[model samples]
Target chain A: MGEVIVITSGKGGVGKTTSTANIGTGMAMMGKKVALIDTDIGLRNLDVVMGLENRIVYNLVDVVENNCRIKQALIKDKRYPNLYLLPSAQTKDKTAVTPEQMKKLTSELRNEFDYILLDCPAGIEQGFKNAIAGADRALVVTTPEVSAVRDADRIIGLLEANDINKTHLIVNRLRADMVKEGNMMSSDDVVEILAIDLIGIVPDDEHIVISANNGEPLAGSDCQAGQAYMNISKRILGENVPYLDLEVTKTFFQRFASIFKR
Target chain B: MGFLSNWFKSSESSSDIAKSRLKLAITSDRAVCSPELMEQMKNDIIKVISKYVDIDTKGLDIKVTRTELDDESGTVNAVLASIPIKDKRPFRG
Candidate 1:
């Protein structure tokens, strides 16, 4: 059976959808049959992020409601043969499906795929609960801002209370320059506060937005953030991979260029 | 000589300079205990103790501490607190 993983965050706009797409694509690139499930029912964006919006004829709700089969709803990625997406329904609310339905859907998909990545909706509401109900593990995504970290902490507490302890942290939209100037929180500070094992640190790369807009994930390229996502995918597969020094390389070059200009 | 003597006087309370006020605030916030309540409790303790013995109520100290719990057992591992009490005065036994 494939491993079911849920990518979630308590606060909105923390790049949960983006991480789901990139990591799913990353796993597919590594020759794993990966299925990315969008659980953000009403306000779905994973389809657009994955550039599969135009191909989504039948959605998750359709599959659950018996309007279509699971294979009919799954949109195969054009670039990666192993990657597939089960888009969420944009017209229906989250109540259209129950947690038991989600569990059944993932369990069925688990047999045919190597990894099942669920892109969870924001907030600790019904949508969030439904997203995580069928997962074997979870990835809590958060930004470095104080408010986001605080909300992420509350979500972590909730997850632990629910007995979902195989949780990992992904710090997204990190700005190294801001951290160096002490204007933003560093990865170390976030880890210290959240007290969870770090899985990935994706820099605030505008390329990620552009890639999502173009339906291409940065993980397919050699971009720093893309490389971070790839490394995280390996780590998820139980590989002892070291985290890349995303800030050091850029800062060192910047300092060297400044000295030369002087 | 005057400048050196002034430096010594200012440096006498180095503890006051090194201690952070925000750290104290965080400790209080984490424990959900207020400084005002702590002060009142200290006063009440001093009053009760003086009634039992001729103790120097001005020389007592009370503080609250926090501790972290064990990770595997999900138990609190550390305790952090602040306690306030009457200052201890060196005097008769």
Candidate 2:
């Protein structure tokens, strides 16, 4: 059976959708049969982010209502053959699906795929509850800002209250230069505040926005954030992959000089 | 006028900026203390404590500190408030 992991955050615009697409793609690239589900319902954007909006005929509602089979609603990724997406129903609200329904759907999907990634909606509402129903673990994504950390802390408390203990942190939109200048919080600071195990730190790369717009995850290319996502996917698969050192920035000559000095 | 000016200058002593706003907010959130009620309680505390002891009214500090009561349990927490009293006794030779 495949593991079900939900990518969630309490605050909006923290790149939960982007992380979902990238991490799903990363896991697929590792030869895992992965299915990404958008649980945002009315605010569905994972289909557009994954660049499969045009291909989505049936959605999660259709599958749950038995209007279409689960396999029929699954959209295979063009870039990675192993990756698939279950788009959310834009016309329906979060109340259209219950947590029990989500659990049933995921349990069935778990038997067929190696990984089922649920892209959760922002806020600790009904949508959030349904998103985490059948998940074996959770990935709480947040930025280095105080507000994001505050929301992330609240989400962690809620998750713990719900008895979801297997949760990890992913600090996204990190700006190393701002952190170095003491203008923004560092990954270490965020981890300390949130009090969770760090899984990944995606840098504030403009390429990510552009790539998402183009329906191509930066993780498919040689971007730093992309590399971080790949590393996160490996770690999720129980690999002892070391975290990328994002604090240090070195030019080619500086790297060579450091190598010689060492 | 000069004495009043000196008094005012002395009253404006530099102190460390309060860096515990977030901590205070978190404590109050956990404790379910409304901001208005918290202010009133602080004033009442100052009024009650002043009757017995002299406090540095400007330097008066009343903050809620949370500590884990135990390691085995997850919901273990305690809130404590610290209020320092000024030394009012005259120096003895």
Candidate 3:
């Protein structure tokens, strides 16, 4: 059966949708059949982020309401044959879909896909509840800000309270230069405060913004953030890929030399 | 004089301040005590202790906080309270 993982953050604008898109694409690039579900019903943006918004004829509510079959609502990404997206409904609110419906949908999806990723909405409300109902694991994304870290701690507590114990932390948007100058909190500091296992860290990169603007995810791109997402995907597939060193920007020669050491 | 004072002062980095503040905030968030429950608990404690001694009720301070264990194994959520006694009650035998 496929693993259903939910990417969630209690606060908005902390890279939950972006991480879901990249990780699902990264897994698909490794030849795994992946499905990305956007659970933010009223404020759906994963379709746009994945560049599949134009092809979304049917959405999550349509499938849940039995107005269309699951296959009809699933939008296949052209770049990756193995990747697909289940876009959210912009007209309907969070109350339109219940947790029981989400559970049934994800259980049905597990039979066909190798990995099912749920992009959760912000806050600890019904939207968050529906996204995590069928999830076997959770990835909590947070930046190096006080508000994000505080919300992350609350998310971890809520996850444990709900018995979703296999949760991991993803520290995103880390600035290594700021960390070196002691102006920003490092991933180590975040992990220590959150007291959870670190899966991966993505540094702040302009490429991420550019990819989002162009409606393309950073999969197989020669960027540090892209490499970090691919590393996270390999780790999810039970591969022991060491984390990319973001302490300093390495030259092409140095990176090439490190490949030989591996 | 401003430059000399600035050089003499030990400046704390903003990241360090953020870390310490976050740690403090999380510690309280994990303690999980409602304001009403805390107030009821304080009143209960004060009522029971008032029979033994005269305490300054307004001076009572109580809060749920995290602290390290004596054996240093790990930290735990502890209810720390400080109450002042104005006078001792007469012994009734």
**TM-score of each predicted structure versus truth:** 0.77, 0.78, 0.83
TM-score of 2: 0.78
- Candidate 3 segments exceeding 4 Å error: A249-262, B1-9, B39-93
Write down the worst ten-residue block by lDDT for model 3 chain B. Answer: B1-10
Q: Report lDDT (Cα) of residue A250, candidate 2.
A: 74
Deviation (Å) of A98 in candidate 2? 1.0
Classified by CAPRI criteria, candidate 3 counts as acceptable
DockQ of 1: 0.08
How accurate locally is residue A77 in candidate 2, as Cα lDDT from 0 to 100? 97
DockQ of 3: 0.35
Ranking, DockQ, top scorer first = 3, 1, 2
Highest-TM-score candidate: 3
Which 10 residues in a row give candidate 1 chain A its minimum summed lDDT?
A253-262
Model 2 CAPRI rating: incorrect
| Candidate 3, residue B23: lDDT | 93
Residue-level lDDT of model 2, residues A90-158, one tens digit each, is 998789999999999999999889999999999999999999989989999999776677788778777
Q: Write the per-residue lDDT of candidate 3 for residues A191-252, one digit (tens) a residue.
A: 99988889999989999999999889996689999999999998999999998889786799
Q: What is the lDDT of residue A183 in candidate 3?
A: 83
Q: Candidate 1: lDDT of A256?
A: 72
